[model samples]
Target: MTGPSIVVAGGGSAGHIEPALAFADAVRRLRPDARVTALGTERGLDTTLIPARGYPLELIPPVPLPRKPSGDLLRLPGRVRGAVARVREVLSGVDADAVVGFGGYVALPAYLGARGRVPVVVHEANARAGLANKVGARFAEAVAVAVAGSGLPGEQVVGMPLRRSITGLDRVALRAEARAFFRLPPRGPVLLVFGGSQGARTLNTAVAEALPGLVRAGVAVLHAHGRGGQAAPPAPGYVPLPYIERMDLAYAAADAVLGRCGMTTVAEVTAVGLPAVYVPLPHGNGEQALNAAPVVAAGGGVLVEDAELTGERALAELLPLLTDPRRLAAMGAAARASGHADADERLARLVLDIVYRHNLESARGAVGSDDRATEVLRPDPRVWRQQ
Candidate 1:
């Protein structure tokens, strides 16, 4: 209670965990003394990721929302109570000054627990808001989004919070080295392909079928086919990776990218100023398409439906763009123009501001006076770059 203790709540998929970790990273930088604990559930990847990031992990019961009317819906009330109560215990144990949440199942409980006790800050990383985020926004003291039109409560679009490796990547200077790391030639346009830990079947199949032709067209490739994906003999000018630990190097080696249009992907691609061909997941609420809308509108990237991303289509749509220097440069510039490379720091400042302000008011016996006039401070830019 004496020092600011921040809790970042986002669990399950990499989409949720990555941003939470990114925010935690920035918090550690800006508030070195602040204790940052990751709020997660035993059901999610946080069991491994949180501790791996050097943050204490606290598990809570998950209350996943049913998509339709069902028996699960009937149990919603009881589940919410259990989850919120556990979150309350976690908050109290950590002396939480604020709950900074990237919306997911865990975020809802974190929001409910922090309602009157500590200020809640919600961050929506997609163009369309999810159920937990929508609910969290109603009570959040501050709201941040990756892009406009999130349909969440806030107009503060700070873009996605990303690690400094991406924000500070000097692609031009690292190109030769990145190429060398991938065992690629220093010249020719490179297409860096990745589709997450579980390979996107569409990307894997299409790229494989198009590989020989892509090489014939004078394009080199560094493709991560996900762990346990299919394998084959290494072709000339093509490098296949089972996993990519150094994305900074990958981005440096890429002239253009081929991947799905998720918020994290879009943010990282744009933050590093690379042209991408986004293939949105055909299912879900179509938020994937919306996530890529701004970049497509800016002529920074191309959006293709997953069902339509065949080998021929990829060649027709991607070949010219990847090969053309002028077009690639312009698209990269446009992508960078739409990026918020400093979002991690910006949101960290916002979180610390809300926490410190609330603490000051409590000290002055002015708790809950609705005074959020805290000025956001920026850390020296050199600090992040040096890191």
Candidate 2:
């Protein structure tokens, strides 16, 4: 028999969608014939991401909800009904033996609409459990988490799945390739700055304020100011891109990273073995800082609180490392050591195990209804072995 088909439903941003793609790729690696579909709203990054990855894409209607019992609460029931309908419609054509939700607004309806006989798994990518993942977790056969602190049931610490391009980068080749890609100086330290996708205004402001001194110290900088951030005019030693297209090259080129502590960013940095100065988003319950704590605790990076990330303090934290080559190398090695390279493979197997088990249970249930209660269907051993 052919390998079971699976659906990955999540998006809205690259952080959630990219990891889903990584898991899908991992599944393809193990079961070449397995069919994988990505279901997300057409409005999200999925429109570009799914097609670019050459996966079947399905779009569903958006469900708007309230944060604090606003007037939108009155329309809650109708919105949910519409969302469920949209999810069912999107899922109807595909024979998904399993469904995996990487937490986002899109995940909630995907899980609710697909949950029953088909096994479902939810992967929460934040330190704090997101609402979509939290709701999906209750019905999920298993839950995967990027951070250990995510408070969700059936939680397994899988780390974040990184793309093969980034994960497979060879260190020696990366060093040379990265330098060529960024056009950096032969042997000077390079600082990479980013703030997830939307760009942290606070982080950008601080980096811009501190740039002159960093330049004076002979440190090269490759900055991703974000799509909507302060546009500082170009300087001799600094290169600012609104967005970075080639992350592997950027990671390879950096001696150190200074950025927000989104779970995805932290995982990518750890995977690449690049040390960072993390400035976690101050609002939203400090989840970003919580995500970065493990790396900081492991001595792989430094965490700078948003309130404390002034120009002088940022300089103070970054300057010593730029000047000390040995310390930077040690930090980079430590960061890489903290990453889990096998995360995508293990997560893919776990998802399949749940699906196979659910299928067997369903088969047995059908047998009982047909007055063959004593008979039970056993899945082929190959499924278990593959899982």
Name the runs in model 1 displaced over 4 angstroms: 228-234, 366-387
TM-scores for all predictions: 0.91, 0.91
Look at candidate 2 and tell me the lDDT of residue 146: 86
How high is the lDDT of residue 68 in model 2? 72
- The sequence of per-residue lDDT tens digits that candidate 2 reaches over residues 1-387 is 457689898778888798999999988887777789988886768899888998998877666545677878787667667877877766667778888999777787788888774778999888898778888899888989887978899689988888888778775677877877778775688999998666788788888888888989998888888888875556766878888889888988888999988888999899988899999888887799999988998889999888898878889999999889999989989998887766788789887777666655676687754223223433353544374
Give the runs in model 2 whose Cα sits over 4 Å from its true position. 89-92, 231-236, 361-380, 383-387
> What digit string (tens of lDDT, one per residue) describes model 1 on residues 280-312?
988889988998899999989999899999889
Residue pairs with backbone overlap in model 2: none
Q: Give the 10-residue window scoring lowest on summed lDDT in candidate 2.
A: 370-379
Model 1 vs truth, CA RMSD: 4.2
